[model samples]
Target: MIIMRKHHFLLSCIIAITAFTDGSQQHRNTEDVSDYFEQIRHDPSSLSAFLTAMPKGADLHHHFSGAIFGETYWNVLTESNGWMQPYTIEVDTAGALHKAPWIHFATLSRESRFDSLKQAFLRKASIKDYDPSAGPSDQHFFSTFSRFGAVARYDMKTGMQEFKQRALAENVSYIETMLGAPDTAIRLAAGPAWEKSITGASLSDSTTVFNTLDQVYAALLKAGIGNTAKKFCHHQDLLHQQAAIDDSVFMLRYQLHGNRNEQPLTVYRKLLIAFQAASMDSLIVGVNLVSPEDGVISMRDYSLHMLMFAHLHRHFPHIRYSLHAGELAAGMVRPELLRYHISQAVLIAGAQRIGHGVDIAHEAASIPLLEVMRERKVAVEINLSSNEFILHVKNDQHPILFYHSHKVPIVISTDDAGVLRTDLTEQYILLATRYPSIHYNDIKAIVRNSIVYSFLQPDLKERKLGQLDSAFIKFENQVMFH
Candidate 1:
C-alpha cells in the first residue's frame, strides 16, 4: 500500500510539473502576442489581419438562418425556382403566388436589363446599403428575414456547409447555433392543454402555478408530445447525417429555440418540446428564447415566459437554456420594462447564459445582478455589430466594458453574421479597437468563455476546449514569430 501511494504521488508530481511548464510557456507566448497587438493596435489593416488569423473558440449565440449570406440565399432562390416580388424582395418557393409583380429569380438573373433590379433585391434581402431614413434600423434589420425566409426553407445542408466553411476560415472550431424549434402542430396542440389547466389559475400562487404546469405537462404527454419530440430528434439526426458537418477540426451543435413573440401557451409548448428534444439528442445541447424582445407579446409576457421556463426547469432540471433578455434599448421599450429583464432572466428563469444583455445598466439592482452573474459564472454574449445596428448602442455606451469591469464573464459573438454582414473576427476587431482597455489576455479569456459557457456536454466540451488550447498555442506562436 505504501509503495502504491508513493507511485501515485510521483505520477501526480510529474503531471503537475508538466502542466506548470506548459502554462508558463503559454503565458510567455500570450505576452508576446499582446506586444504585437499593441504595436499594430491603431493600424486597421494590420489589426484586421491579426484578429482574422487569431483562434476564436466558439460562437455561442449564432442563428443558423441568419448566418447564411444574402448572396447564398439568392443562389438558393435561383436554383429552387423561387419567385421574388421585385419591390418588396419577398420570395415564394411554393409557386403559390400568381401576382403580376412576382418575378422568377431565374428570369431576373438571365436578362442583362434586370441587373439593377437584381442588385436592389440583394440589398433588400440583407442590411447591405441600408438607409436609416427609410425606417428604423431594427425594422430594416428584422424585415430581411421575411424577404429571404423562403429561400432559407429550401436547403438546410447547404446553409450548414456555408456556416462550417466560414467558421473554419476564421479559426472558430465550434458553433452552438439556434437552428429551429418544434413544428406548428405540436406547439398549437399545447393551447388546449394550457386552456384546460392554466387559463384561469392565479400565477401568484406558487403551488397553483406548479400544479397547473404539471397538469398541462401531463396532458401534453398524453397527446403524444413525447413521440413528437422523438420524431424531431430522429429528423435532426437524418439532417445531421446528410450534412456531415462535424469533423476533427469543426463541430456544430444546436439550440432549439422558442420565439418570445409568440403567445404564452405557444412559447411554453415550444420550450417543452425544446427541453424534450435536448434530453434525447446529444447534438441538441440547449434551448433558448428568441425574437425581438420589445415586441408586444414578448414584452407583455416576458415575465410569464420566464416563469414558464422556471417551471420547465423543475421538470427537466438537467436541461440547460439561455434567454434573450434585455435585447432592448431605452427608446425601443418603456423605461420600466428595461429595469428587471436581466435580473429576472438570471434570478427567476435561471438562465445559464444571458444573450444580448445590452441593458444591464438599466436593470434594477444592477450591481447585485452583476455580482450574482460573476459569482454564478453566468456569461453574457456580446454581439457588438448587432447591438450597434439594432439598438444604436455602440462604443462607450455599450455595456461590454461595464460587464468586464464588474467581473461578469463576457463572450463575443455574431448574433446574425450574414444579416449584419459581419463575423466573429470582426467582432473581435471591434472589441480590440473600440475598447483598448480590454487587453490581449482579456480578449483571449473572452474567447475561452465562448466554449466554457457553451451548453455542450462535459466530455465534448473538454475535447473542444483542448482543441481551442492547441489552436491558441499555434496562433500565438505564429504571431510571435511573425
Candidate 2:
C-alpha cells in the first residue's frame, strides 16, 4: 500500500511537469509572432512585404461591386465589346480639367477622340480622384457606385472572380461579400398586398410570412437568377480545379443586400429575396443592409426595417444578417439617429454582426450596450480606411478602441477595397500603426473572431480554424525562424 501510494504521487508530478512544459512552449511560439511584428515596424518595405503574405482568415464585410477598380471595370466592359463614348465629368464648382483616366495608351487608337476623354471617364467612374472640395466626401464615395453601375451590373461572374482572385492572391482564405442575383426583382403588383399582410406581425407568424414572400419571388427565379448564382459557384469550382487549387484553400460565401434608400416595401422585397436566395443555395450565407445609412428614407424607416429583419430572421432562422449601423457622424445625420442604431441592430433586429459601428459611444446606453455586445459575441466589422474617408471618424473618434477595451469581438475588414484603395493587410497596418497600445495578441484574437463569427456552418468553421492554425505555424516559421 505504501509503495503504490508513492508511485501515484510520482505519476501526478510527472503529469504536472509535462503540462507546464507544453504550455511554456506554446507561449514561446506566440511570443515569436509578437516579436516579428514589432521588428518589422521600423522597416517600411519589409513590413509591407511581410503583411502582404500574412494569412488573413477572412474579409467579412467586403462588397463585390466595390471590390473591382474603375479601370478593371472599364477593361471588362471593353472585353465584352460594350460601347462607351468619351464623356467628361465636370464637378459643378471646378471648371478645371485634369489628366486622362487611361494609365496607358496601348488599347485605344491614338487618333480616336475617346482617348482624350479617357482620364475624365476614369475619374467619373471611381473614388480614385474624389476631391472633397467639390462635395461631401460620403456623397462622392457613394456616387462612385452608380457611375460604374451600368457596366458592373451586367456581370456577376466577373465580379465574383474579381473578389475571389484578389482574396486568394492576398493569402485570405475566406470571403463573405455583399452580392445578389441580378435577375431577382420585386413584382410591383404584389408589393402593396404583401406589405399589408406582414405589417405589425410577430415572429410567431414567420412561417406564413416566409411562405408568402417565397411565392411572391418565385415567379422571377425561373427567368435565371437562381441559375445565375448556381453557374457562378459552378464556374468557380471549375476554375479552382483548373488552377489546381484545392477548394478548401479558397472559400467564398455571399451576403445579399437590402438597399435602405428605397421605399419600405422595396427594402422588404429585397430582404425577402435575399433570404430566399440564401435558403436556395448554400453559398449564399448571409444578408446585409447597404447604401448610405444616413439617407433620409434610411433614417426615417430604420426601426421599421429592424422589425422587418426581426420578423424575417425568425422564419429563416439559419440565415445570418449584419447591419450597417452607426455608419453616421455628427453632421451626416440628426443627433437622435445615432443614439440607438447599434443597440437596436443587436437587441431588436438580432444582427449577428455590425458593420462600421463608428458611433457606438453615442448610443443611448453606451456602456450597457457594449456589455451586451461582449456577452452576445456579436462582432463589429471594422473598416478603418473607409470610415475615415467617409465619416471623418478615426483615431480615438473611432469606436474600435472602445470595442477592444470592452472586450467586444471585432474583425478588421476591407469595406470596399477598390473604392477605398485599401486591402485587409493595409487595414491591419493601419490598426497597428495608429494604436500603439494594440498588441499582437489582440490582432490574433480578432483574426480568430472573424472566422468564428462568420456565417460558415459550425462544423466547417471548426475545420477551417484547424487549417488556420496550420497556416499560422507555416507563416510564423517562414518569417520568424529565417
Query: TM-scores of the models, in the given order?
Result: 0.92, 0.82
Poorest 10 consecutive residues of model 2 by lDDT? 89-98
**Predicted candidate 1 versus true structure: per-residue lDDT over 147-189, tens digit per residue:** 7665666688888999899998999999999966875364435
What's the true lDDT of residue 233 in model 2?
A: 53
What TM-score, to 2 decimals, does candidate 2 have? Answer: 0.82
Which residue runs does candidate 2 get wrong by more than 4 Å?
1-26, 88-116, 181-246
What's the residue-level lDDT of 53 in candidate 2?
A: 81
Error of 1 at 43 (Å): 0.7
392-429 in candidate 2: lDDT tens per residue? 98888888889999999999999988888778999988
Q: By lDDT, who's the top model here?
A: 1
Off by over 4 Å in 1: 1-25, 94-99, 184-207
